[model samples]
Target: MASRLAAALLAVPSAAAAELPAADLLIVGGEVHDGTGAAGRTADIAVRDDRIVYVGPDGERAVHAARILDASGLLVMPGFIDPHTHADGDLLSSDPDRRENPAYLHQGVTTVVIGNDGGGSPDIAEKAAGLENAGVGTNVGLMVGFGPVREEVLGETNRAPTADELARMQRRVARAICQGALGFSTGLHYAPQTFAETGEIVALTREAGKRGAIYDSHLRDESSYSTGLKASVAEAIAIGREAGAPVHIAHIKALGPDVWGSSGEIIDMVDEARARGQRVTADQYPWRASGTRISNALVPRWALDGGMPGLRARFDDPEAAARLRTEMAENLRRRGGAETLLITRGIGDADRWDGKTLAEVAAAMGSKPIEAAIAILRRSDARVASFNMDRSDIEAFAVQPWVMTGSDGSTGHPRKYATYPKAYRDLVTSGKLDLPTFVRRSSGLVADTLGLTNRGYLEADAFADIVIIDAERFVPRAGYANPEELSEGVVHLIVNGSLAIENGRPTGVHSGRVLLRQPSRGTCP
Candidate 1:
């Protein structure tokens, strides 16, 4: 290892290597993938404090180092940034297991974008302060959420916001951006956001645009439920065009049999929008199955109009109850039938139904599958891995230039623990995308999408968030049956220049920082 590292040191121009500041840690003799969809090169990177000071051929003479890692024969790249994750809730947990965030580390992730799907509070400063104060395993970035703001203003009411209420919501968004929120995020498919009209979203996103924040959203409808897949995408594009900020579609997918092969259509929509000078992009998970609640999968949007009270009231009315069952049955069929739904973590009596198919659970309960799903939803919010996406659609969307990779959630599915490595193995290695493109889509592209000026690359003066992987050995160990298992690939992981994982294991270090979105220096294209 020493001799191989010496070769890298000898490879640099002697003059360029002379007289540099001492580095806290030095990585030598690695295949450097700079995260720009470029070819890899043999290079060494020197880190001082939390920034990369040198990223040239020779490092031994370029900078003095207290600690030197002999990273020979490994692929050193910018640590991946997950665009959407549910891990933010775990950052403040008392349980060590959750705080450690082993799943993220194992998959070579050094940064996580949290408060996605409109779940984070609009009080972005307080949330960011709390996580930083508590200390996290990886870098955390907060996206001010629309759900909490709407819930606060409307209290789950299925109605458009009054003009005064709209002004309040706009003020909240502007305040969040000033407080260092990356952008605005909305899960319009979920209530009370579902209650929001298109004009309402356009108004809110316009506020985000004025503050130079991205508009991130979980598309309103991905199936045949309401606007349909194509129209939902158009809605997102319309928001971006009217708001005048870049729009990001969270977890872009052609979900359900009805929407399968719709990725091509989505691409065309984005392309046409781009032609019209609209900045539109998206992120996707590698899996064909998407994880969500049973209630969301079965219940019609109209049935959930007025929150729990309205839903229960409708159930009490015989006519409404009959209609609810009929619509829910159609919704179930649109999801490719109950047999396609796998109960990953069932709740209450449904706990016994975990790891079972909806078809099997329904048989066990001596009821029809749709009826069984409705019963489970009535009892508790059971989660499932719905295997409705087509492989062709997955590949079609993933291969797009505007698309990046993300793990929408971190439970009941292998994606949470294994999305990056799985994408590397299945997509890159399988020739769907080359290694450089894969790294670019996952890292630099994501950073660019979110306007992260100082991260997602192994560049000088950039934040020293890095990953070293033994490509031959890097593989995801997590599976459907064992979704929480740690992946095996990241032999060394560094968060903000501190070693967080070594030799394919965590080093018990919590050196993460709260990364905030930076305002652009000039007008953006």
Candidate 2:
């Protein structure tokens, strides 16, 4: 079959090469899912100078020139645009010689939005320049984080931003957007950010929102931790209203036992919001377990109030330490206890503790699970895969059209290398969702959400970010035990007319660019 397809592609008996405009590459006779939420058609895709010049039936306008690739019997679709990721840190920290992002390309991702969770750099232009100058494996976009902006203005003080300080934060957010941040993101559940009042976040959102930037957030709380998951969703929605920007909830989930069936409620709220003309959407990983640091899940946000100094001071005082322990115990309960947390990435010296459950580690140390967790936090924090979600909730959210796919992570969880494929294999292929809908949510919806002009679709003149997949073989090979393994079955990947993956092998081409938000497209400086 491979040979036949190759023969068919090589024999390009159409318009003469000299008669047609030049093309960098041509993919012929494939099932073309145009990333438009419509059924695919058999067509040929042609790339030239970083853009798709043609997409139609086999002997189309863009076909005569360039190399021919036979994608016959495979799915040729838009290379995925992941809305949330932490890969910027990865690429920046990668060995200079090996800057290619294997984890994403292996999973068929061609673009990733970094600096997510309110932790993306404030100096987006600087990061963009660095990535472009150093060369990157995939097209990367930035989102200025609320966390950094707040830290810059408030210095981790547990208080509301003064009016003057608030003014400075607004300027920072506006500056990031002008320099090309796709949106403003918030890790409201995390520190310094958690110290912010709802009104303060609304003020920051307006700065980005008025620039047509998206308001994306890892909600203040997903479980019953702070205001309960429902209230957190409502708070996000309210912020959207005050800011006049679309609201996007990050890694939307009904986390923990208390929030088990809350997917229904969350879906309804978003549905009703849209019905009322509010633009609200959310991204979710395919896996049930969520990835985060050990301190984040078990420690109460209140105890970590004044940053490291406050935390150290509390730990030093015996009474405060006892109170901290009690609060930490309650926080652990909300996540269904320590057994639900699996340490995936360990800190220095404690590296041997990876791959063990918190409960198991506690048993080995002859200490209570909470005590062991506290000790581990004191020594060093490790990333964990918290298995506190219900399978029903994951699927329930998966089927919702407003719920798009995002890894919400990097390295520590299987989702980093498996989110899209898992969704495709389990949802689309298994008939829970039709193919068009899957493509729409995964690529088109996300692109539309971010207002990316020529990406996430296979139309003529769009960026040549495409992927050819063997649906049957495009499976997530990485498991919790061996979390670093790359995914499989991406036969070809093209990013901005450069072949990053060709015929099932990585070519290490850093053909990616930092996408700038066009001011003409309703964005402000």
Candidate 1 residue-wise lDDT, 444-500, digit = tens: 999998878889999999999999999988898888889988889788999998999
How well does candidate 2 score on lDDT at residue 327?
Answer: 88
lDDT of 2 by residue, 1-525 (tens): 467545554665544545667777888888999989989999988888899988887544445545778888899999999999888766776564345778888888888899889998889889888888888888888899998898887878789977899999998988898888888999999998998889998998987778888999999999998899999999999999899889999999998998999899989999999999999999988887899988789778877788766776787799989988898888888888888999998889667788999999999999999878877777788889999899999999999988888887566788877788888888988889998888888788989998888999999999999999998899988889988788889999999999999989999788888887753254552
Error in Å for residue 371 of model 1: 1.8
Q: Which lDDT value does model 1 have at 110?
A: 89
Candidate 1 lands at a TM-score of: 0.95
On the 0 to 100 scale, the lDDT of residue 83 in model 1 is 91
In model 2, state the lDDT of residue 450: 88
**What C-alpha lDDT, on a 0 to 100 scale, does residue 515 get in candidate 1?**
87
Best by lDDT: 1
Q: Lowest-scoring 10 consecutive residues by lDDT in candidate 2?
A: 516-525
For each candidate in turn, the TM-score is 0.95, 0.96
lDDT of each: 0.87, 0.86
